[model samples]
Target: MLALTLSLALGTPAQAQDADVHEPSPAERARPDDSVAGSEKLLLTAGVSELEGAAGGGLTPWAVIGGYGTRDQIGASAFYTRVNVPDYHLDGAGALIGFLDRIEFSVAQQRFDTEAVGAALGLGRGFTFRQNIIGLKVKLAGDAVLEQDSWLPQLSVGAQFKKNDRGAVLEAIGAKDDHGIDFYASATKLYLAQSILANVTLRFTRANQIGILGFGGDRNDNYTAQLEGSLAWLLSRNLAIGAEYRMKPDNLGIAGEDDWFDAFIAWAPGKHVSLTLAYADLGNIVIKDRQRGLYASVQIGF
Candidate 1:
């Protein structure tokens, strides 16, 4: 009688505890609503902001959407970048918002300081060229993070609309228009097991000096195809090193444009902030050739 009572007591508690437990359905587990406030994404997967305010490397856009947002969350981020060359300086600031990890909208402004070269060209000594950029990106197919078992990479298509303030100077220098648009498609693959990331972008544009000197010129006024590529190695969850190559259009005869290259290091202490520094070779800008410089950028947000 004592053993029977003891067993009943233990079995009653166990049965009550099992009845109190809840198991989530497969559908509920697949898309959890707890991913709000832009949380739950892996570090360095969204990438840093490029010059045009898109989520990408230092100079080119990537396939991933901006921020740490998942499928059911909204994310926001902002960034500032400065590039110092021997004869010039470029300052860029921008912000972006991601919706449901599928679409991104961004806005950016750029100021290019001419320094002594401006006076030599009959412009003011401290003359500056200002440009504004608005960008949009939409994910087309695949998932760089979730679909690791598949060979299909994440793909996105983006566009940038640019407007330059120096219309008179641009016209005098043979630029065809003061405002233009650029379109590109990017593919990105993240090899999680190998700690590697690779991206390739195909761009169609006519911008000169990336719109600092306006769009198109006497040399070439039509949109042409260009290529941009990046490769990165993740040293840890928070740190990555990468290199980028961007081919540019040589539209202006008065000033020959050259391809751009950069080796960069990006660090993300957390999901909310990141820092990137690089040695950039701009090749040629206006009268200056081999315009090597230091590039630094900071990004912050959810």
Candidate 2:
């Protein structure tokens, strides 16, 4: 009888212990649901809605705002770009300020340094020229992401007014002109986002960069149409690699047409800073040909 009683008591405790083992702890029950909620918030805050580059091509084209203030009604940004080649070097600094998320106004200054490596180009230490660029861009169409499902592209119309400071340069090069304003219009489209990306741009501008020493050529007071294209792939979250090609006109009589291409890599550590490095092949300018070199730029914005 004692043994039977002891067995019943032991079985009763064993059943109670099993029931406790199946019950979940309060901490464990709350963790998975909390983790899911946190992940959703992160996705909403950091979507693929940031602007990638400042320009449509080598020139800054109108692009939407990017990063933390991407959703804000107003934003501002600044950039410094340097291009070095065998015959020419250029440095440009600029700023862009946006208003009401619909319009952007920008100004930039460029310093051009040329080398005397070509035919009869004797003008004492080459020539130093300056260019002031003022631009205005207005959005005309759909949103960048909201209209993703539709066929319409986020459209913007932009104009660049360029002033050349060629007083000293023209006198040294035996040219009559001192300074002039060049106007241009640009149309840009961004297609296929995320992993694979493509951008197509067309610009019409009247400039004399092709005419070396300010000598008259096909580039003077003539509107020329150019096409620029880029294809990119996202390797990871903070890095992208791409290739670009530009088709430009041949306005200089001393050389063949100017056709160039570049391969580049860009890195964005955070929302406020980005850096790009590239290798470019500049076909020819003036009598000097096959000018190839490095290009780099850094951009900071808030």
Candidate 3:
């Protein structure tokens, strides 16, 4: 769970301040009540960035497009995040641009620090695995923010193209491939009356460690179906509490990878900036068992 915000797309930074003190921009104030394609006077973090660079939760991508623009406008944002486990560290950064509230394009870079495990594996004391990801998403149907009374949810389809830097090391560890593309479809629903947001995503992937450890392994070279989901409660206009569960594949035969989950709290003190804190259970990584620790992220966008 490592995705994170941008508040520079819709209005001035002052407008993003605490929800209680937030001032509506002219565009937002003039928006029609029936607007469903774009956000209207919503908190900047209403659509959190997903790990793969799409809009949603920390692990699962949702249906909503990224950025702060309305249907008639274009919005964009950039983010950086860090996850610290007992024996490992992960750092990621990315930028996303949304068009007409219908399409999204993004690029992300991830670095996986092996720490002591790198020495154990004879790769040095602080060996790292790096990967670059390019992603695209299209809004397929429905509206997550609007149609609250309807049973239908917003839906989208996305793809992530990942390339790892350590091809030789990956192959040495039984990885069948060092790169691959992942496909996924997601649905998200916002229940304003109930102050809850829920999402579910199904993915077809062959990546190990979400592609940080390379794409496929000798043990399983084919793509497998995986699921990710999130449930959140809006405590206030700019505050939310949530839990996420993401299923992962055990492709490498050397060390087993377990599913991931987290309990998180997100706060947007202003429309331009937001922060998220979480306790994540990453199961096991390499030689370390039960890799659990703090996850933190900060974003500034429009």
Candidate 4:
């Protein structure tokens, strides 16, 4: 989905030498089980930084907070991601901090390269669109991790403020604005006994191409509701397999947009680092069709 590609790494480690082993800190050595909130959560429960910098699956933000910190501690992480398709490429990087396992703050920037398609649109070859995003999230209720016996899932609400740099170019393509805000609420449940994690998010947005093509459009200038969902299977403590689907709006009359989908593998060899790889179908972008390719990301932090 043009999203997180949250977790899976070909399932198992074929060779231990391929991954660098994380050296434990002195405190962890002295008290393994009581190491603190930084490593207290189950491995991989602190979701990866998503495309937009929120914690969750690759393509969509889940209800889970961004880190392993509990009520009295803090946790943070940084991430880099790249998506390569036939006619375009997207690169993003961000960092997030979680406070008291209840609130999250993040910042990210994205670059979308049109490649040869830029020339077709008379925008020059390799034209690129750059955008910046700031996000905040607050947990509303429940706990996806510790409340396994409860039927309720974790609930959270978030907002993203995005600004695009190429205002003139974006308006030339029928975009109504160069900036917009997105609001979303997510619900997530972790079924440890079943080894499954599921999430659903409802988003209110007006951005086009996640804001690379700018915000709103001539077709519909107001925000619209969209849906995002993720399902993951825990194959092991460090491995997970999942799929994601995210609905998008067809705002630009000239370029018909399609929904996005992906299948991903994520692996976390240690608590400090994780990697994700996915096959993503991005449907069509401005002047290109069938924008399908690889999605890869790396995250590092406590």
Deviating ranges (above 4 Å) for candidate 3:
1-41, 44-46
Top-down lDDT ranking: 1, 4, 3, 2
lDDT per residue, candidate 1, 1-302, as tens digits? 56556756677657655655688898867954675676667888899999989999999999999988888888889999999999999999999998889999999999999999999899988699999999999999999988999999999999999999999999999999999999999999999999999999999999998899999999999999999999999999999999999999999989899999999999999999999999999999999998999999999978
Report the error of model 1 at residue 276, Å: 0.0
Model 2 steric clash pairs: 56-61
lDDT of each: 0.93, 0.55, 0.83, 0.89
Native-referenced Cα lDDT, model 2? 0.55
Highest lDDT, which number?
1
Model 4 lowest lDDT segment of ten = 1-10
Model 4 over residues 1-302: C-alpha lDDT tens digits? 21212222333443442343567798767844433456566789888989999998888999988876776678889999999999999999999988888999999999999898889889899989999999999999999988999999999999999999999998998999999999999999999999999999999999898888888888888899999999999999999999999998878888778889999999999879999999999999986889999999999988
lDDT, model 1:
0.93
Q: Write the per-residue lDDT of candidate 2 for residues 1-302, one digit (tens) a residue.
A: 57555756677656555654667789767743322112111111111211112344343343442222333345556778787898888777887766655666777777777756522566556566777777676767765445547666556666666666765655444443444333333333334455654555565654445222333343343556777666666676667777777666554444455766888777767656667777888777656688888878776664
lDDT of 3 by residue, 1-302 (tens): 01112443344465453543657799878955453334343684347676666677877777788887666656777778899999999998888888877898989989899998899899998899999999899989888887877999988999999999999999988888889999999998888899999989899999998998887886798999999999999999889999999998899998688999999998888656778888999998767889999888776666
Per-residue lDDT, model 1, residue 81, is 100
